[model samples]
Target: MICSHVTVPVMIHLKLHELPAKHVLKRWTRDARDIIPPEYLRYQKDHGPLKYSSR
Candidate 1:
């Protein structure tokens, strides 16, 4: 899943051993923020004239 404004790139590479539904959710929740680029935080704070898509 790609984040709004193209700030984050999330790739899900699942191995057969990690197929459990609960484990998948846990992994995704744990790593979600790490996928986002640092610059995006700055942009969010600025909230200047530039407008980003909300998706």
Candidate 2:
């Protein structure tokens, strides 16, 4: 994750088992886009699937 204009260096990284599901991700995406400005967001790039948790 790279952002030139950042408040916090990062958000806490969640483990794969802790990640949100598709429906929740969809809703969060919608809500975040609604509140967060376009400039702050910038471009997005998926890094492929997360490392799977053995747990």
Candidates in order, TM-scores: namely 0.20, 0.18
In the range 1-55, model 2's lDDT, one tens digit per residue, is 3342441333343323333353254436645555656554444343354455697
Model 2 Cα RMSD, Å? 17.7
Residue 21 displacement in candidate 2 (angstroms) = 18
Angstrom error of the Cα, residue 27, model 2: value is 11
lDDT of each: 0.46, 0.43
Estimate candidate 2's alpha-carbon lDDT, on a 0 to 1 scale.
0.43
Q: Per-residue lDDT of 1-55 in model 1, one digit per residue for the tens?
A: 3343432222233324333464355436745555657666554443465657898
Worst 10 residues of 1 by lDDT: 6-15
Q: In model 1, how large is the Cα lDDT of residue 19? A: 37
Weakest 10 consecutive residues of candidate 2 by summed lDDT:
7-16
Backbone N/Cα/C clashes per model: 0, 0
